[model samples]
Target: MNFLPITKQEMLERGIEQPDFVYVIGDAYVDHPSFGPAIISRLLESRGYSVCMLPQPDWKRKESVQEFGEPRLGFLVSAGNMDSMVNHYTVGKKRRRTDAYSPGGISGLRPDRAAVVYSNLIRQTYKKTPIILGGIEASLRRMAHYDYWSDQVRASVLMDSGGDLISYGMGEHSVLAIAEALAAGIPVNEITYIPGTVYRTKEMDSVYQGVCLPDYQEICRSKEAYARSVALQYENTDPVTGKTLIESYGTKGCIVQNPPAAPLTIQEMDDIYDLPYMRTYHPSYEKMGKIPAIEEIKFSLTSNRGCFGGCSFCALTFHQGRQVQVRSHASILREAENCRRDPEFKGYIHDVGGPTADFRHPSCEKQLSKGVCTNRQCLFPKPCGNLKADHEDYLQLLRKLRELPGIKKVFIRSGIRFDYVTADKDPRFLEEVAMYHVSGQLRVAPEHVSKPVLDAMGKPGHEVYLSFLKQFQTANRKAGKKQYAVPYFMSSHPGCTMKDAVKLAEYVRDLGFMPEQVQDFYPTPATISTCMYYTGLDPRTMKKIYVPRDPREKEMQRALIQYRDPKNYELVKKALELAGRRDLIGYGPKCLIKPGKGEQVSPGMQKKSRKKTIRNVHKKKGR
Candidate 1:
């Protein structure tokens, strides 16, 4: 159960001549399932293949990637769990001071667009060796799509990095298939039939059962085409009903993305989590300080994969899909026992959840066989009548984990789906959560209080959130606990006008909570929200929506969310005035802003301005 080798010295010490794969990663090597590189590397090792990890190699130096020399099969690359662009920059598109995934929580360990950068670096040294790209960065950019940073539609990452192929999505099944093929002496260039992979091909003629997307040039020339293309890609994400998609890049050829690999069975899910993970960062990184990303998940257990919550702003639908595949309770309990034995165990299990904590199975039984609805959402607008809203399994799992010998507490901090919680016919789960699980407070994403904005965000309407809030409070009261519901709110989302921002400010003001943090909508790749932010039309409905593109207006929207702050007073006042609600700019109890100490303009100057307006009207009449 020790870590796979990361250096040539370690490889030789293990009696390995040439490694089977040289794994290049954007993040520091952490042999934990939470890290994508660890999963791929460990899985390869379990199959009797040698893998050497090259973490955060300096793209500037050719010797960095040369450390592993070359591998027998190929080199597998990933940009860690998070997209490098999202890692490097904030929602404001400003450079962040630290990278939590890096050793010492440092910045600049990996360059922006790390997958492409690392892939290109590897190609500089090994021209003919297979280069396989995976993880969030490569997965999201695996086709002709928009780049928020560059503010343009870029070609597939396979094209951008010149990588031989890309293994998208969770990549557990697809990667294994790829590894087997490469080990069997298949050339990387000819191995294009694997599902969940995107590859460049000159002959689209060989592709079957495919939908041809608009050429890159056509999409680039018209936002309409781009939206349509993105919509098509979105529809064909489910493994049960999806088709192979092909998009051209002029004379160079085309990029083909095969249908996603089928969801892992319960046994398979259990097997993946059962891998012998060291469950911590490499020991060699000890001197550099701890990897901050491990702090939350150090004692957490992932109970499931994929989400049916169907958040428009989320990339899970595109990556993990909508089917909920979970591990058996026996597997989770085993992980909990292992947690108890760790030297650092403090009698606390941080979380036991996945993309959404409360979801233990698919929203409905039919989803696994027939696929989720591509056009409509499972929980948004309204929870469907067919919704299998049950929490018996998750509740039982929590109870078992809590009753473990060394466990003092089990917190559900991975984030619970509040909407799902409210949909349950029984309130026992809510009451139990309030009594035991929460760590004094629970965080939920009711992104906003405005219905129109929530609709555009593909979130359940405001009433559902309000209903959930009441239940949360009532449960807390009955449990005699002083628990708080900390709602996460976002500002400047598409369809959020200044009027809506004011309404949100008023709602928070009534609740007597002025949030300290507000997210200005980030236009990350492949999400419906990102598409709307770029094209100014909702991709789901192709309807024009108001976007707060003006930098100052966006600032005002943010300020309005925290209107109580003195620094935001001016911005909030201006926003209120611009929304034609100047009545809200005074010291009334309902007012969002306070009045100034002095008049904005002299009475004489105002009279003169009024007279000049009259004169202009008379002059126009004379003309």
Candidate 2:
């Protein structure tokens, strides 16, 4: 129930002369399931490998990385749960001031591109110690990708980090395979055969029947080529049908990603979650007031993994893949009972789900063996005829947890696939959620209400959200609940124009909810929408797409979502006028803003006189 050694003295106390592996992470060492390195290390320790953790080593000094010295097996590098650049910067490309994963809620603990920095630091010290890359940062960048902060296509992270190999995806199986391979005295360079791993090689012969992606040079020279390459990479993510993919990095080298490993079975998944997790940030971080990232998951349980919702902006398809896997009810109940033992337990279980809360299996039985379709999604456009929409199992799981002793409330805080919920004929699931699960407001991601934008984003049309909203309201009404649906909307997504923004504004207006926040489509690595944002070509169809790239336009798109806000009045007015829909500028139920008054001030924007804008002043006077 204690954490692995993070210092040489602790390792010596544990009677270890030299560790089998040194896990270098960009996050504070939290031995919880939510942290990737913790699971892999614990799982390896479970298999009898001595592991030590080096959390957020100072990349500026080689001495910091050599804290544990060279390990017998290798050095494992990860940039933590989130991509480092994403963690350190806002979508506006401004440096973030706080890092939740770091001790004391501080930023700047980990360098940007932390995996690459840490790995190279290891290379500087122990040149040939089988530097291995894993976790979200390495997983998403294992192949050629568009680096947002750099605003250019970059080569695989393994190349930059000097990592001998990379264990991609949820790497319980592949990471263990790597440890076993190294333990058997296999040369690090020759260990490219492991599925869920990426390795660079000179001989293509070693990669049997691998799909050759567009060469790095070609993909970089042409955006269309990069789009084509990304599409191919996504097509091969399915474990059932994926093949090894090889990308040439010039005449001297090639990076080969073996087919993704098959998902773990229920018992295997159960065992993984049941590992000896201390279930909190390492006690070393106690003085830092706890790692902020551990707060949500300290008592929350992850019931499943993998996402089939298939939002184009999401990177889950490349990382966790779409094959849903779950733990047994007994396993979950056992964990819930354990939660009750903690002195901090407050008669509630924060969450009991994973990437998608309701998914306990693949979308359909065929997906189990046939894999998710590469060209289309399971739920978008509309649910496929073969979609298994029943939530009976999930409902039963919820009911079982609800009945557990000392558990007063079991909430579903994770994303619930509303489309999946409405697709089911049974109303009992919705009724149950309305009655018990929602914490006053249920969060759902509609992303955007524009049809074309929704289509480009791999999300269902606006009507799907509307349908779910109506059903949710009816359910809450029947249950005598006053719950609300806080739909998440994204602005400035590819194919979303000012007109689309206006459409979304109209929809939000009718709903009488001016959202406090909106996500400007962040072009993170390895997402179809990111591809479109960069390449202006839909990877699925290669058709030309529109991207709201100009900062002002992106701002306007965001402002339109909250057009009712006095602060947003100027920006919304400008957006309406720019889109040639000036009719929306007048004071009418259909109008988004009032006509220009005394000072000809813009709506949805603040005036710079250090005083309230005309709209704000008008709003204050109860206009």
Candidate 3:
């Protein structure tokens, strides 16, 4: 019912001499399950351990970390919910105007490389205090990985941050285990044996049966080696089938990653979500303004925690693993009921799913016992034959939420795997979602239309998307609703050529759809797509691929997605020429854009530029 203490006085008011953990985060203090710091702090508090939240502490001064002094056990550092670089800068490496995670939606609140910065800041004040890194930044960067901003392979965050350990992935199980070990007076250096953690050590004698990856220097020297390392890491993501991975940092030390912690059971998932969360930003920020991130999730319910869709561009496989762990219907209903009780409740539940919304259980029953297959995906290339592809449980859950009092609409705002929908034998789930869950337009990610590009992105083919679109329209018509399917597409992905970009633009023109926003491929750390972007080699297959890294080319690819816009006319025209599709640049029905005056057209082209007269010009000017 109460927010965790953020100030020393607040801690003292709660009668704590010193907190068991001082959680230093790079985001504003928002005590919601959606925020990692909130969950860890609340979970610790539930376990009789006091925690003081130190959010967005000033990295310029060491005294900022000295606010609550040293903790009884250690300092937990996280770069909030997102990686600091990604939060601060856009895919084009331009600084963003605002930060959704900061108070008042302001920018420049947290330093770049926040986990490393915050951890170093803490080390300045308390030299010997154990600093344990967590959250997306630390989790994905727990090894020597590619850094897009710097264009170099960086060391493990555990080494750079001077942190004793990294509790990677969804750290509920590992963090709790770490707390118990620390509380038992175990030294931080001796806590390497814990699962779902990474630590550095000089001696590898004790590392039993660990898989030795190429040294940091080796990967830094050879892109092929780096690609090989990424492939190895990808294969060992399954907790049940993973092995202890060790990587040498030359004379500095070797970083060892313990096998991931086992996926949470249904009861454990329920218990974690059931934790008492104030579920909003700290009240002290009433004047500063609202935390923008909370608004999206305040009324939402997280029904599941893992994804098996195996999208190459996504970091879910490395972070949350491939196993899908979900909460019981009762637990989700309880959370939804609480949302309804809030004064801000507007008879709408914003979302009711997790990483992949409709995934209610493990992809296959065998996943519950043996874990997902490392070699093949459940719903990539094609859905595995063993894939259950059931939606009845999820459908029932949605039905119950809709029937709840004071709830007029319960939306599925999260991304749903359309391929999975097509794979299911039962059509009721798609029909019901189109009829009830969609808010006029249902959002889905087709990513790209080109086979080579979609293959590189590890997404379903255009045919699959086409089939789903037909089904969606049919369902909407049957239900007497006029909903639309808003398919999301990405640009500049590896293996995508100007020809492919033109193809996509032609598709957009034919459909008469202009996307308001487009995602340009960003090479964040630890993703298979990022690996391809960096090495020009597919980590999965080691095949050489074409990668577009020039900013201008990337811009043209992005502009192709919104070719209808006036601002993108020049870029779209340029892209069409480069793709050898000059025929698509005139007054023809299939043309992406009309040829402007003075623009040259290829000889024998069906669509050609025409000279505009004085009368035509005056007409355009409304004369």
Query: How many clashes (backbone N, Cα, C below 3 Å) per candidate?
Result: 0, 8, 0
lDDT for each residue of candidate 2 in 1-623, tens digit (9 for 90 to 100):
57899999999999999999999999999988878888899899999999999998888888998887889999999999999999999999999999999999999999999989998888887878899899999999999999889999999998888889889999998999999999999999878778899999998777789899999999999999999999999999999889889999887689999999889899999898889988888888888777988778888988899988888999998999999989999898888887898899998889989989999888989887788888778998899888999898899999999998888888889879888988999999999999999989999998988889999988887788889999999999999999999989999999998888888888888888788768888999999999999999999999999999999999999998888788888898789889888866655466678766764534443323224456678889999
* Number of the top-ranking candidate, with TM-score as the measure: 3
Off by over 4 Å in 1: 600-623
Candidate 1: tens digits of C-alpha lDDT, residues 287-396: 99989999988889999989988787899989988888899999999999988999999999999999998889989877878998887778888888889999999999
Pairs with backbone N, CA or C atoms under 3 Å apart (clashes), candidate 1 = none
Q: Looking at model 3, report the run of 10 residues with the lowest lDDT sum.
A: 604-613
Which parts of model 2 are misplaced by more than 4 Å? Answer: 599-623
Residue 454 in model 2: lDDT = 92
Candidate 2 accuracy as lDDT: 0.89
Off by over 4 Å in 3: 602-623
lDDT, each prediction: 0.88, 0.89, 0.92
Q: Is candidate 2 or candidate 3 better by TM-score?
A: 3
